[model samples]
Structure formats: C-alpha cells, structure tokens
Target: MAHASSTHDPNVYFVPHSSKWPFFGSIALFVMMIGVASWLNEASWGKPVFFVGVALTLAVLFMWFGDVIRESVRGNYNRQVDVSFRMGMVWFIFSEVMFFAAFFGALFYARQFALPWLAGEGDGAATHSLLWQGFSSGWPNNGPAAVGGAFQTIPAWGLPLLNTLILLTSGSTVTAAHHALKAGHRKQLLLWLGITVLLGCVFLFFQAEEYIHAYRELNLTLGSGIYGSTFFMLTGFHGLHVTLGTIMLAIIWLRCLKGHFDRDNHFAFEAVAWYWHFVDVVWLALFLFVYVL
Candidate 1:
C-alpha cells in the first residue's frame, strides 16, 4: 500500500506513509549478532544462522534501496528533499568518523599509556614490579606472556603502499567520473567510474593477499597480543568499508548506464562520491598511522 507517488508537486515534500524494511532489517541484525557470538564460541548451528541472516539483510537492503531509486526516478524528490538527503549523508559519514576514532584511540592508549604502565613507568613502577616483574615495555610487546608467541609485522612499504596508491588512484578516477557526469559526457563517465570500480577491486585483492601473507608467513593474527589485535582490527574494518564502497560504485555504474541521473539532479551520485572520498581519506590516515608510523 505504501508505494511511491507518480505525481510530483514542487511546493510539497514527499513522505512515504509506511515501510516494513526497517523492522525486517532489525530482525536480521539481531539474528546475525546472535549467530556471530555463537559461531565465535564454535556452536554447531551458528554458521548457517549467520549466513541466513546475512542473506536476509542483503535482501532487505536491496528492496529498500530499490524503493528509493524508484521514488527518485519518479520525480518524487524536490530541492528540499535533496538538501535533507545531503544532511543525512553528512551525519552518516560523521558517525563513521567516530567509529574509526574509537579504534585509533584504543591503539594510542595501548602504545602510550598501557604498555608503559605495565613496564613500571611513573607510579606504575610498584604495580609492574609486583605483577609483571621482568616484562619489557615495547611498542609491539605481546605482554609479559607473549600472548600468541613471536610474530613478524608486515613491512609498510609493500602491499600497504600498493593499496594506498590504488585507493588514491580510485579517488581521482571517481572525481573524473563526477566531472564527466556533470559535463554530460556519458561515455567518459562510464569509463572513469568503471576504472574506479576496478581500482577498488584491486585494492581489496591486495589486502586479502596481505592478510594471507601475514597469517601464513608473519604469524601476525588477531590473537597475537595488543599489537596484532589492533593491526587486524584497523585494517580489517577498513577493508570491509572498501568492499561496501566498491559495491556502491558498481551500483551507481549500473544506474548511470540506465540514465537515472542528469547534470542538475544527481544527488545519488554525489552521495556515493562523498562516501568514497571519505573512505579514501580514512585509508590515508590508516596508512600514515597504522602502517607507516
């Protein structure tokens, strides 16, 4: 019953009467979380439940985004609606910023405060002497016990540098695509967007190869103490973001081919571009702090 309106009124805001996607999405998330917890604990049924939840969640998102696309194509959005969408995306990216900030904060705390305290620095001398005794405070210290045994860290100049270049190149290509779209050069837009998508895929592939090398050769793992934990946590999450961004770019490419947007009314393209740029900036920070420094 809650379908997009075919008729448009420039003076009024369009509002959907109701939607079921949110409720379904919530249920899917709940199931997924439970499954993840159970799977981590090695429960037998957890794998199936997790995959099922993931499938359902993806289905819900597809349907939900399809609805929005239909609405946009129908001219249901106005100038005010565009402004609202832009503000919403701005807040969404802000929230993602905070999300990464928390992890970086944890990394800083571990390196600057926690490790030193454990090694008997300042007032922690008594505590460290009493508890950890011979524990040496090091940047990549695996605690006094050597949590996951000895491990080698990946060199920053290798795959990480390559991935950084890939992302930077992708950012430029996406910008070119944006310019092409605005200039009404559909062929150029498609070519640039396709290149951006390919770059994203290459970045992801190299990241996966890096992970394999880390695990098999370097023995660097999530359980390899705070250093390893922080390493994987930061890079892993960033990879996930890249994957999502790539998918979005692909979807936008398809939409562009379908002539869904024009020069003046292409907020959807702008929104995804904004997100991709944000992703590029985040990777730059990650490279400087997590990999280089």
Candidate 2:
C-alpha cells in the first residue's frame, strides 16, 4: 500500500522501494508450470490449477502496471529513468530477436541437414543404412518413422496471406497514429489507434480459422512431424505476440482517451509502437519462410 515518495529530487534517478509483485509473479509462473506438467500427464485437477495460476498472474500484472502508470503520471520519471526505459526495451526486443532466430535456425538445420541425412544423401549413406532405410528426403518430410502420419500443408495464398496483409495494414495504422500524436491531433490519433487494434483482432481471427482448417481439414497438428511442429511453434508464438501487442494498443487507446500522454512525453506510446512494429516484422519473416518458401 506504500506510495512512491514525493520528496525525491528531480535531478536524481528515482527508484521505488522493494515491491512484492515480482515475487508474486514468479510464484504464479511456477504454479502455472506445475499445472502445465500435470495437465500434460492427464492429471484430473490440472485444468483448474492452470486457470487459477493464469488468473493470479494476470492480476499481478494488472496491479504492477497500474502502479507504474501512477508513478509515470505523477512525474516520478526523469530523463535518466526515460533513458533507462529506452535501453531496457531495446535489449528486450534484441532478446526476442534472438529467440526467433533460434527457432529459424532449427528450421534451417532440419531442412538442410537432418532430413537430407536421414534419406542417405551424400555422406549419409552409412547413417541411412544403419537407420531409416528407403526413407524419402523431401521438404515437409514426415520423418523416417512417420511420427504423426500424413498431412497436407495450408497454402501460402490462403488465410496466411490474408493475415499478412492485415498485419501490414495494422502497421501502417499504428504509424499514422504515432504521427498524429506527435502533431497533437488527439482525434486522429485515437481513430488510427482504434483501426490498428481492429486490424490486429481481424488478423487473430483469421489465424484461428486457419488453425482450425489445419487441424480438422488438413490433418496438420503439433505432432505432425518436424514440419507441423515447427510451423505451429513459430506461428503460434507469433500469434501470442500479436495478441499481447493488441492488448497494449488497446490500453494505450484508453489512456489516450483519458488525456494521459502529451506531445513530448509519451514513451509508453512509443514503446508499444516499437513492439507492434517488431511483431509485424517477425510476421513478415514467418510468412516468407514458413508459408511461402
């Protein structure tokens, strides 16, 4: 219940005293992990436990962010704090880039090396002889053992393409909103940000439909060999990022309505914009590598 101290000097960097949110968040995450493990093993109580953990985690985030927003609005943040925030966001985005890079690397290695080796191409003759015989080495191979049975891939020209366009348009809308904010046009800013949020929701809807088609019609699933696994892993995580970005945009929209940001002091808006743009770029990569090529 302690509030940020109001007696701090403006020239110095402000730091809040120890907060319990991090500890609570960590505990929630641990509980969620336990629930996930239990659910995977078909424990009867896992679903409820997982839901409880998720609710607890979200509550913690809500309270924690509310505190931060209160602090920002109270002018507790200065130039040094702003610089630190910028640096933190930059490094966070960099880490996210590396995370996706790892996934892409796995895809590349599986396609260029693992699949070909399993099929006895080049120097893999001995490996093939000792292991999977008569296995085909093709793009989208179901592995030598046929781990998840045969399945058809969703075409690049279908819902995936539509979602791509939606994300691109949303990117434009968000950029326009940023420009509007900078120009002190609150009406235009709200309009464009709302459009961006709508586009994000549309993209997510299409993605869900595409997932349904993959599962029911195409027989594609998480267990559908390397192709299916990698496809879902990349797209699913990206979808989750889009969901988070959209939520952030929505929150910003509400803040804008309350006259929370001024022309020159809106790093919160900029940070969310940066994140949304990053999500767009990652989706572009996913479209090219996972769907097109």
Candidate 3:
C-alpha cells in the first residue's frame, strides 16, 4: 500500500504495476458487444444476455474507476501525468466531436441532397423529374414509395424547447460549480454541481416522456424513414452522452464529499466539467438541427 502511494520526484514519472482491471474490463466489453449483436439480430435470448453484459460492464467500470480514484487520492500521480491526462481528455473530446459531426452530416445530407434525389421536389415548379413519381421531396420524407408510412414530427416548441433550456441552465450551474471549486468553496461547489446533476436527470426524464409520446401518439419510430431514422439516431446518441456525463458528475460529487480535491488539484472535477459542457454544447446543436430546424 505504501508502495502504491509513492509520489516520486517531480521530474520522474510515476509508473504503475500490472493490474487485472484492463483484462476484466475487456472481457466485460466483449460480452456486451456480443449481446448487442445478438439483440440486433432479434435472438430470443438476446435481451437477457445483453442485460447481463451491461451489468458486467458497469461493475468493471465501477471497480476500475475506484482503483483510479484510490490511486489519485493516494498521491500517486504527478504534474507530467496530469498533463498527459489532460491531453488524452482533449483528444477524447475531439473524437467525440467528430462522432457527432458524422451524425449531423448524415442529417444534413438527408435533408439537402437525399431529399432532392428521391423522386422530385414540390418547392417551386419542380426541381427535378420524378424517378418514382408520387413521392414528393420534402423535409419529412419517408422513402421512395412512402414505404416508411405516415408519421408525425414532434413539435419544437414543447419538450425539446424545455430540454434546451434545461441543458443550458445545467451548463451554467456546472460553470458556477467550477468557479466555486477554484475559489475553495466546497459548499457552493456541491450545491451548484448537485443542481447540475439534477438538471441532467430532468432533461433525460423529459426526453423519455417525449419519446414515449412520439412512439405511442405520433407514430414516430426508428423505422419511420429518413426523417425518423436521422432524428432518433442523433437524439439517441446525445441522450447516451448525457447519461454518461451525468454519471461522471455524480462520481465527482461523491469525491467532493470525501474532500478529495483542493483548489489547485481537482482535475477529476475539471475533466467531468469539461465533459458536461461538451454535452451541453452538443445538445444545443442537436436541438437546432434535430428538433428546431
């Protein structure tokens, strides 16, 4: 235990010994992926298998992160390691940016280009001749032969609008929490951060309600066609991000309660805060492109 807590000289990098967490984590992810593939194929046992995998994955993450938190609090990390962590986080966020950009690009292409190619447009006299006829190009296109069937779009002025404000407000609260941390105000930090996490929960709850309404009432679904597919893909992925961010923020809040961070040494908080802000930004873009626009 003393060896694990060794901080080393400032100029020397701290090297960690062998651990089984990575191996276990890899196994958990492999199981999860297998379950996902099975579920996608509609296998009878897939749902149960997938849930077991999810449980395993979550358990591995909990243990792995617990080890990291223990190491960090034990003063095993140094300035150079900190710099490396920061760089890794920056690149991780960059990759996330590109990931969302691809989905947004798909949405853009579907609206601008694919819509035009699918038969013809009725915007003016007619932009192009119909390849299939009867299928008019428009914003909420189903498919070439209206194969996706009729579906209704969720109004931008309702749950989506409220969610937008909620995320924006969560962003501000997280920022306030960061400020409080920097100022060494633990109470203020916890208050604002707790609010931010609650706001995240509220956003997710409302989104789930909106989804229920869309599926049960509006008949909107993944199979609803181009509009439906793009809409669900974008929003679903963003919701997943929000869930992960909320979990991280909650973990950081726990660390705060344990007095694990000081004014100048709260990289975990900063990293989670960075992720939350990124989530907020992505939601804004998603609200605009997927909802309002």
| Best prediction by lDDT | 2
Candidate 1 pairs with clashing backbones: none
lDDT of 2 by residue, 96-119 (tens): 999999999999999999999888
lDDT of 1 by residue, 1-293 (tens): 11223355656888976999999999999888888779968899998899888888889989999989987887777776777888999999999999999999999999889889889998889988889998888767677779999999888899999999999999999999999999999999999999999999999999999999999998999889999889988999899899999998999999999998777778888888999999999999899888877
Clashes of 3: 0
| lDDT to native, each model | 0.88, 0.89, 0.84
Error of 1 at 3 (Å): 17
TM-scores of the models, in the order given: 0.95, 0.94, 0.92
Report the lDDT tens digits of candidate 3 across residue range 1-293.
11123346778777777889889888888888888789878898887888888899899889888887878878888887788788988999999999999999998888887777655644522534435666666777777766557889999999999999999999999999999988999999999999999999999999999999999998898888888888898899899899999998898898888888887888888888899899989988988877777
The local distance difference test score of model 1 is 0.88
Which pairs clash in the backbone of model 2? none
lDDT of 3 at 156: 90
Candidate topping TM-score: 1
Each model's Cα RMSD: 2.6, 2.9, 3.4
